[model samples]
Every structure is written in structure tokens, then in C-alpha cells.
Target: MKDKRDFRLEIASIESAGDYVRDILKQYKCTDRDMVRAQLFTEETMVYWTETANEGDILQINVRKRFKTISLSLSYRGAQSNPLAISDEEEDETEFSFIGQNILIGLSTVTYSYENGYNVITFTLKEKGTNPVILIIFALAAAIICGLIVNRFAPSLGPGLSASILIPLSKAFFGLLNAIVIPFLFLSVIASIFNMENIAQMKRIFRILFSWFLGLTAMSAVIAVLAGMIYFPLQNGASTGVNEVNIWTQIAKMLFDIIPSNIFQSFLDGNTLQTIFLAVITGITMLVYKGRFPVISKVVSESNLIFSTMLDAICSLMPWVIFICIFDMLLSGDGRVLLSSIAVVVLICICFLLIVLLCLLSVALIEKQNPLQYIKTIGPVLLIALSTASSSATFAPHSMIASNKQGIRDYLANFSIPVGALFAKPFVVPVLLLMTLFVGNFYSLTFTAADVVSMVLLCVILSVAVPPVQGMGIFLFTIIFKRFTIPLEGLAMAASLFMLFDYLMTTGNVFSINISMLHTEQRLREKDKRVIVYNNQKC
Candidate 1:
């Protein structure tokens, strides 16, 4: 069918806009939820325009479907006006009149511009349930099929095609990821610190919770190193990359090297350790002197928003990157190497499961609660985490379970869940360690004692420092693999496997957060009991 639909309606008859949107969305067989959202968006914009424009003014609407993206554009040729403008100076504009504007904004990608003397507003929405992970998997399968076909029929063309197209595109993808990681990391850390509410008031709980996060991550790192050594030892061809320098000296240098003499140089060099240090210092300075320098905070906030949106756009390219990378690997005869890494994937999954179970049991026994019952209570949260692969997406249901079923204090649960959603990463530590080791051994790059120490330290720091956002899995993989001086092929391999690991990693993170909250609640209760007993004795 037709990909484009358009309509011109009088401002007074704007109510019909909803019907127009409904008809177009239904043509694509969009879900009812999407239909309703489009209709609501149409109605809201129409109402706002109806109020702002003359009675007889005409509003032109265009709806276009491009693959999975459904874009709607509203244009009017009168004096410029933005229907989505929230703070326009109008006598009729009330706070209540703008109630649903933010919701509409959140529901879709909204843009406004003045082009060709017409004020245009556009809303772009994606079809629901289009899981990027599944898309990447399908792309991988398609690439394998196509690569095999090409390899059998036209063997001579494989090398040229890979060298010319796939290799350049693969480099471009990593280049984009590499360029964005440092700034994204810098802004995200600052934003996360600034986002926390009442840090002074919640310092006690924050310290306790932060300790739990670190403890879990450190434990995961230890497990990964030990397990990696057991399951996948260095082969005969592997080189340990050990230098003549003393291991202790290397450790000392790494520890002191985090403080950058020139911050700009640190940024230029893409030094994450120094970047993280700078971020912490800047975040705390902004937080302390927040009232004195409001403009810097505003700039930081706006910059974070811009970078976050750009990062999402980059992440959407992942499926394409996966297809090309896999296709290139097959053409280059590295398919066998990739196939051998299945054991590594399986091992990572098992380690995550074991960690989750261990945390659950430890928290249950310490709090005197039944482990089975705890699992049953948080099962829905885990299911959402597994399906969505987003810790924030599971926040609402997890909060409900924590407060109502688990008997966690409401305020504590609310505070802890948001903090956990952002900072708690139970799976990243182990996954990073294990994958790096596997790749190291694959490349015959041996890790000396100092190398292991440095890698583990870096893993634990990055796990908590990086915000859990879309595309962060790929970003983290790039950072960890690159830091270890592992080759680009290792990074590519890890990036390809991230689609499968993300779901399990997210679930593990959710599971660990739930347990940390339980422990936090228990500690608070015990502290209160002690205070009460001491006060009674004094009286």
C-alpha cells in the first residue's frame, strides 16, 4: 500500500484529526496502543492549534510510514506558532491546559521547525515490541546464510567485498562508539550524581547501599577471574604480555596515574580512569556550589540530554553493525574462531545465574526470610527485566513488590530502587572480566599478575561508574576490551555477543538490587531497635 496520507482541515474542525491519525495508523496494522497514542497526539496538537489560530485557518497534516517508523507532520502557513511550545506567552494558556504535553513528548520523538514559511511539527514513533536484540540476532542469521552462499558460488569476490565495504563500515561503527564513549561517560556520571535527591539526608543509606554495590561487583570480578582460569587457560601459543618491569611498580604506576596533570590531555587520550576522576570532582563541585553557578548546571543538563539522544540514535545502528561484522568475519575465515567462543557465552551465563542465586540466598538467610518466597515475590520483576533488558523498565513493578509484598518501607524502597536502577550493576563486573580473559587467551595475549590486577580494578570501577543506558553494553565492551590492549576483533566479537548477554545481565542486576534493598531495610530496622533500647536504658 500507500506509504503517504495527507489531509487539510479547518481549525474549527480539528476534532477530525484523531480520525485521520487512526485511519493511517490502522493501515499499517499498528497495535491498538499505538493507534490510541497517535490519536491522542493528533487530538492534543489539533486542540492547541485550534486555540491558537483563527477560526477559518487551515492546518495541513501528513502521515508517512517508513519501515518501522511512523512519522506525522502538521503544517500551517500562518504566522509561526509551535503547537508543542509549552511556555508561549498567551492569555489563554493555563497550567492545566498543558497537562498532557509532556506525556505526548515522552511518547514520541517530537520536532518543530519553521521551513518554507510554514510552521511544522513532526512526531516520529516506532512500532512497539521491536526488540533490538531480536533484530540483531536475525541480522546475524541472515548474514551467515548470505555469506555462505556467496563464499560457495563466488569465492574470489569475498575478499574484495569485505575489504572494500564491510571493513570500512565496521571501522566507522567503532569510531562512532569510541568518539561518543568518553563524553557520554563524562556527562552521564555528572548527571547521575546531580539526579540523586537529598544526598546529605540519605548519606547513611547511600553509603550502605553503595558498599553493597561495590561488594557485589568485586565478588563478581573475583569469580570471573577464578572461573576463567579454570575453564579457559592460556594456550601454548599465547603470550602473557608481561614486561621486564616489576609487577609491583606497574601496579603503583596504575594507581597514581588516575590523577591527570592535564585534564584536556586526559580527555584527548580517552583515559577513562582520569575521566571518571574528573567527573566525580566536577559533580560534587556542582552539587555543593549549585546555587552559585546555575548556568553551568543548566548547560550540563542540556548537554546531557543532547548526548543521550545522539547515543540512542547511534545504538539504533547496532543491528546493521552486527550484520556487517558477522558477514566480514565469515568472509575472512574467522568463523571458526567465533564458533569456539560459544563456551565462553555459556560460562558467562552460568556465572551470572550463580551470582544471582548466591545473593538471593545470603539476603534471605540474613533477613530471616524464606528464599523460595522471596523469589516468588520478585519473579515478575525478573521476568520484566529478562524480557525488556532494562533495569529502569522493571522499576515500577519491583517497587510495588518491595513495598507491598516484601514489607519494605515505602520511602526506603522508592529511594533504593531508583538508585539501584542507575548505579547497581551485578553482572557487568563478571561479564567484563570473563570476556576479556577469553579474548586475551584467544589472541594469545597473556595477562601478567599486574595485568590481572589492573583489569579487575578497571572492571569494578567501570561497572559502577557507567550509567545503565541504551547502547551502554556495546560502549562498556569497547572500553574494557580496548583498555586491555585487546585487538579490534575481540571488541567486535564481544559486541556481537552483547545482544544475548544483555538480557541475562539486566536480570542479574535487578535481582541484586532487590537483595540490596532487603539488606538495607534490615540494617535500618536493627539500627532503630538498638537506638530504642539505648534510650530506654538511659531513661
Candidate 2:
């Protein structure tokens, strides 16, 4: 592995590591400022890793320079310990506390992983143009201008063209995302379950994320329920046709729906919740009955590779899809009213995002790293989520940022993100809750405690189950409105209106998962004392 992009170091000593790193940065044309940071992070990391390694273990550094980001992926063997992932409380006593303070957990995004027999630690830095701040600014401005023109001057023309052409194109893009996302979710979740080094790691991370999941969902439900309690719009035109279903029957049906008699039917029907349930059962059974089904794991892993490659191809088209969606959305006559009506939803979602960010900062502080770096890593991804409002569209950016910037292990981030994108939803809950409330208020409907409980539970379950792509939110809202006897007239407006707010919800989720990954790594480091490093000869 000796290319301009890859370095294979057979030497044991760490003395030349600094010079090697500086030369690599220079070769990659990284800015002088980035060069300085990369060099410092690299030298300190090498020193720390080298000291942790057993005698005579080989060290390798792979350099990847992509536009405005450069990553140094170091792989070594002989120790399984991840000292680089130590907590702030444990930072003081280490021999390389300065290195830990200055490099591994410094200005760079340092992520650690143990693959095979080697510890692969990646130190990454923004090389300029890594953040999509400028792109987002330009996109927003362009969308606003284009939207206004299409709505005012060529209103009929825009809507007609959008309905006939742009909307379909966007739907096709969504279809493409749908095609890959389900398989990606199925395979990635199963793979993570199979590949987890520690069950407790997954449990702890799940507890935190699930708590946020429930809490956010509760927030949405509480707001909707409260709004329903006090707010009533003109009900002169309220529908008398909507009927509430039997709560007990619905609950039994929902439980029954989780498991399908024919697993293939779940896919054909696009029953994502059922598919996930099946995948979980399959994952657990396979994990318990290992070796009897080795080939299944291999097949799933290979399929995962194929789907991931497809995901990359589809992500390239996200910008165009976004353009079409915005064009279509802005052209609609209801766009203005929809936007105005959902201001509260958007405001509350932003507040939740702030809380998420605050929590991330706290975690970063405890981990003894700069929280801004976390923001930087996910900034580009967040912008994509904001613009596209599709988690599948944000996959590439999120994976890259989480891997490079947050230093989350490719294994953990890769597994966690796709699975999280579907099952780990934080945004849909609030949006759906708000929409349900809007419908009730707009129709002057009354809600009982049972209605609130059911709606809250539905928000949580559906948020996890529904794939947050185009129209999925609307689809779920329709189901809720019907189930709770809320008028369905406002579904169209509420759904269309929350497109902007969907951005915040998704951006918050992207941030939340990275936080989960970071927590997992820190906890793993805490429990595992042996920071193993190995040479190529044995592995």
C-alpha cells in the first residue's frame, strides 16, 4: 500500500512522523493554515498511537484529500485500546495528555475504530470549501427569487408546468431514494447488529437516542394536544364524515401489523415498519444462532456494499431534485398560506434543534473536544437535509462528515446513520403532531385524553416506521387524521407548508445520530483498557 494516496510505514520509531505528515499535506495542496493543523494533529496522533503500540508493529497512514477536506487514516496493530477516545476526566493522567489535548481531540475531527486486528484512527480537518455555507446561502436566495417569480408573474404557468413535469421528476427522484433506502436500512441495521463489538455499546447509545426520540415525540404531541384544547377555527365547513376508529381494535391491529406472515409482502406493500420489525427479529435470531448462518451475514454484507454504492450515485442528483421540489412548492397557490400557518411548527422545531445543539456541546465538552468541530463536520450535511428535506439525500454528506469530521468509526456511523435515518427519526414526530393539531383546530374538533395518547404514540411509532421522504409525512398525517376523526381538509396545506420546517427536523436528526456515535466511542474507550495496535505481517 504505497501510493501517493497511501503510505506504508515499516519503521517502529515515531520521530519522522511529523515531517512525513507535513510533506503529505504539502503534496495535497492543503492551505498553510490547514497544513499547520494537519501536521500538529498528525504528529501528536502518531506519537500517541506509536507509544500505545507493541514493539515492532508496523504503522500506516493513508492520505485522502477531497476538495476542502483532508483525512489521515492511520492503521496499526498490537493493541486494541482506543486511548484517543478517552474522556475529559481521564485525559490528565495519560503520558500523552498534551497530545490528547492538542491533537487527537483538538481542532481536528478524530474518529477511532478497531477493524480486524488494527486500530484505524482518522484525523480530519476542513481544508476550505468543506462547509456548504456559501452553497446554502446561494441556494436559499435562488429558491426565494425563483419561487416569487413563478408564483406572481407566471403563477398559472409555473403551477401547470410544475404539476405536469417538475413534480413527477421530483417524485421519480424520491422513488430512486426509496428504492435504495429500504434495502440500505434493512442491510445496515442487520449488519450493525452482527458486527457490534459490544452489545452494551449499542444499548447505551440506543437508550440516549430512544429517549430523545420519545421526548421529541412527546413535545410534538403535547403542543398539538394543548393547541387542540384551546384553539378553534371557523367550523362552519367542518366535516361530519370523519369517524374515530375503535382504539382497542386499532392497538391490536397495529401490534398484529408489526409482523407479517409473508416477509416478502412487507417489501411489496412498502410496509417499512413491518420490514424493520422483521429485520430486527432476523438480526437477533442470527446473532444468537451464529455459525449456523454464516453465509447469510456474508450475503447481507455484500448486498449492503451494492446498496451503498447505489446511494452514492443517487446522492449526486439531490441538488436537481431539490431544485424541482422547491420550484414545484413555490409555484403552488397555497404556498404562502402554508408557510405562514406553519410558522409555529418551524419555530418550535428550531427551538428543539437548539436544545439538540446545546446537548451536543455538553457531550463534546465532557469528551474534551471543541463542539464547533462537530458542527463543522455536520454543517454541510445539515444544509443538504435543510434543502432537500430527504434523509436519503443527506446520506453521503452525513456519512462523510460523521466519518471525517466527527471521527466516528465508519462502521458505527455507517450502520447508525441509515438505520437512524429511518428508525431514529426525531423530526417527523413534531411535524406530525403539529399537523394533527392543525387539523383539529382548523376544524374545531375536540380531543379526549385517549385521542392525545393515541396521537402521541402514533407520532412516535410512525416517526420511527415511516421513511421521511417526500409525501411520507402527509401519508402518516392522513392516517392520524382519519384515526382520530380530525378533518382532513388541512392535510394538504399543513403538509406542503412544513417542507421548510422539515429541514430543521432533519438537520437536528443528523446532529443527534453523530452525538450517539460519539457517545458510543467514548464509552467504548472507557471500558476497553487494551488499545491494541498490530502489524501487517500477522493480519
Candidate 3:
């Protein structure tokens, strides 16, 4: 594919670049929407290059299509003028340019690198198949029909057809997603912690980090409160739970289990936080002894290969897993509840994007960078994040987006991305609070302002403490449900009902991590330059 589309054209002939790119899109027979987007992408890349190229430089562009994505590459030998890099004086820009906001942030993804003497900019256009979406719709529609049939015929069928068949199948497939969750968490956390560069960068960025998070956390909580007001209407009905549960025992058990008695047993029992505890200890030990034992460090560095292979295999079956999960849920005769719950969950998720965009654009304006372009290169990372709902799993993809696409310095990218993967939960608290409120209404539980504040504070603390594995949001919410005296029994139903929103929340987490990494690195770089100049003047 690389050799097939190789071309050499003089700078004078660069006007035809978009036409050349359009031909490739035509050959692939992409949708009209995608074709127009690709054309726009090519035009932007051309403008960036043509404005910055030197007198003797030549422009070489390549067009490649793989699976469902198209990569349009523009390589030119020239003096490096990275359009993405803004000057220190420009850092004070109070407004972000929205000209290519969509392409930058979401419409398409663009990455730039300097190789040898050539500047190579690659644009990735992700095509969503209407066919697959339609198929998904059909699967959902099929679930509804199967549900109606099963509910109507339960009297005639002994033990029920769905009970004997579909339910088990659905649980089995869904369980596969959870198979790699713990190991992936352990490997990623351990590997990230042992990397000394990560620690050093964390120290440099620590001061601003808290304030940044504090702002995002407050915004998330505010968003949840507003969303609750709109969606969680007060209902007068019988209380959902009879209040028979003991709160202290549940709290003590959850706290005590965080430190497992046996690490091996914890893995066997799928204890996420306990596994995280063991991994953190191991990572710190490895870091301390890395100089003395090179062999240990070497082996740990290679461990990601094992987990990556496993995740790829498991996540490949995700579409089918989702289909089965939805089918089984419908088959249980709660189709009406499940569908409505999904709609509400989806609304809060849609609202989450606003908060993410607000954070990203705000950072971009202050830093003098384009938010659209920043978000664009991060598309692959966010896509993987959404699919896995595990930052640990998406670490590899995020690393690539950071170094190759976004041009984050190697040390900072390695450090900040993993740290973000582990500790970042910008949207988790708000979304979880919204879920609590939404589900609370079903149980006729009205949340006061104090309850909201306590919930948000707990969420902020828990998001950082928990292993960034799947289902952990609901796990935290379950504890909060107990604390707020909301009845522990309704927790499972809330988890089941609002599972889909977790994917969106995780995606937002990774997205903000990338943005935060960019902002932090830029500030540190500028700070270093200032110190150097100050020392020079004193000398």
C-alpha cells in the first residue's frame, strides 16, 4: 500500500494535491460526506505546507487506505515549521480558532512528524459504516421482537426458551470483555509506575495538576447537577427498598478487601483494587532496583506485549458481545425499562461531551494551541478508549497518538499518558452522580445539596484510587449508594441500566488526559526557557 501511491511533485504542482487526494477517495468509493471531509483535510494540509515550505523543497504525497480508514500523507523536504507549535507570545491568546475545529477535535485526525529532512503530515479519516449501524439497529430491533415473543409465550414454554438459551449465551460473551480487564490493569499500572521518567514528570507537573483537576472536578459535579434537574424528575411512589441492610458491615468489608490477604487469590477472585495494590508495590520495587537488576527491568518492559495480544483478541469480539448483552437484557422481559434507561444514560453521555469540549478549548485558548487539531490526532486513542472502557488497555494507542501524532516529548508523553490512564477521571464523578440521581428517582429518593456534595467528593477520591478497569464506576457508586442511605439493593439495577455510559466517560477521560499532557508539557517547556534566560541575564 505504501509503494503503490508513492509520487514526486514539484512545489509548483502542489495545487493538484486535493484533486489527487480526491481520486483516492473516489477509488475507495467512500460516502459523499467522507469524500467532502477528505477534500477539506487535503486542502488544510496543503495550506500548512505551502505556507511554510522553503525555496528548494519538493512536495511528495502518498494516499493509502487500510480496512476502513484512509491515510493521506504529505511529505515535503523543508525547514521545519510546525503549524501546531505556537510562539510564547501567542500563549496569551484568549480565543481559540474554530476554523478547523471539527477536523481538529472530532471530524478527522491529523498527525505530523519530521523524518530525516522531510515533514510528514498524515491525516486519518475514520468512516462509520451505515450498514454496521443498521445491523446494530436490527439486532436491537430483533431483541425487542424476541422479548415480545418470549413474554407472550412464557406460559406455554416449560422453563422458558430464553431462560434455557439466550441469557446464558449473553452472559458468556459479555464475560469475555472482563477476561482481560484485571491482567491488563496490573501489567499497565506496574509498567507505568516503574518508568522513572513518569515519576520525574509527575513531580514537575504536580503543582498545576491539582488545580487543573479541581476545576474539572467542580465542572463535572455542576454538569451532573444541571443534568439531574432536567432528567431526574421527582416521582411519588412506594420506596423501592424496605431498608433491611446493615451499612457498617458493607463499608467495613469493602475497605478491608482493598488489601487482599493473598495476591494470587485476589487474581483468582478477580479483585481489581487488590491487584492494583500488588502491582503498585511491584512497580515501586522494580523502579528501586532497576539499576542493580537490569534483567528484571528488561523483562518488565516486555510484559506489555503479552497483555496487548490478549486485549486485541478479546476486544475484537466486542460488537457481538454488545449484541448478545442487549439481547439477553431484552429477553428478561425488562425491555421497556432497559430501553428507557439507555436513552437517559445516553443523554448524560451527550452532555459529557460539552464539558470535555469546554475543558479542551479552554486549555487550548490559554496555551495558544488549536483544540480542534489537538483532538483530531487523538481520535484513535479515544476510539480505543471507548471500545475497551479501560485506560490501561488503550495505553499503547494513546502512546502512539502522543508521540507520533501529537508530538508530545517522549518522556512527558510516556509519563503523563500513563498517569492520566491511571488517575484521570474528569467526567467519571459527574456522570456517576448523574446516574445516582437518575436511578434514585426510580426509587423515589430525593437528593439534597449536601448529598450531592458528598457524592461528588467521594467520586473524586474514588476515581483516583480505583484501578482504571471496567465496571469500577458502578462499583464506586454501589458504595456511595450505601453511604447515602439510598438502599444497597438498587445498586445492581443501576449498574445494569447505565453500563453503556461508562464507555463515553472513559473516552472523555483519555481525551482530557491528552489535552492536559499537551498543556502541561508546553508550560514546563516555557518555564525552562524563562529560567535559562534569567540565568543568562544574571551572568
Tell me, by TM-score, which candidate is best: 1
lDDT of 2 by residue, 1-539 (tens): 12233333433344466577778777666555456556656566666665566556677767776644567777777667563444334322242234213321232145556668887776664443332333333454566678888677777788579778977776676556656655666765565455432333446445654555455445545655555444423222223333244446645666687788888887776665576787778778777776566467557756754564465455444444545555565776434543556555654555475556665665767677777766665677778777755565565566677667667666555556655665566655666766676656545665544455556676776676544433454456555665566644454445454554566777777666666657766766664544333333346
Worst ten-residue run, lDDT, model 1? 99-108
Q: How do the predictions measure up, each by TM-score?
A: 0.76, 0.53, 0.50
* Tens-digit lDDT string for candidate 3 (150-235): 66776345246557865566556445545556676677666655543223323556555545655676777677767766676632
- Cα displacement (angstroms), candidate 1, residue 297, comes to 1.4
Question: What lDDT does the true structure give each of the candidates?
Answer: 0.73, 0.57, 0.59
Best by lDDT: 1
Off by over 4 Å in 2: 1-57, 63-137, 150-156, 195-197, 201-244, 289-295, 298-302, 305-309, 312-319, 330-332, 346-428, 435-539
Which pairs clash in the backbone of model 3? Answer: 104-372, 104-373, 104-376, 105-372
lDDT of 2 at 458: 67
Model 1 bad stretches (over 4 Å): 1-129, 234-247
User: What's the best-to-worst order under TM-score?
Assistant: 1, 2, 3
Candidate 1 per-residue C-alpha lDDT over 1-539 given as tens digits, one digit per residue, 9 for 90 to 100: 23444445445465577777787777776656456656666777777766566655677778777666567778777777666544424422242224323332332245566668787777665555467777877888988898898889988999999999998888887888889888988988887666442445456677887788777877788777677767865333234334444557877888899999998998899888889899999988887785477578667866776676677788788888878887888898877766788888888878887787788678667987788888888999999888867665665678789889988877666567656766678688777777788777877777665567677788888888877666777788787777777766566567667767888888888888888888888888899999999999999
lDDT of the structure predicted as candidate 1: 0.73
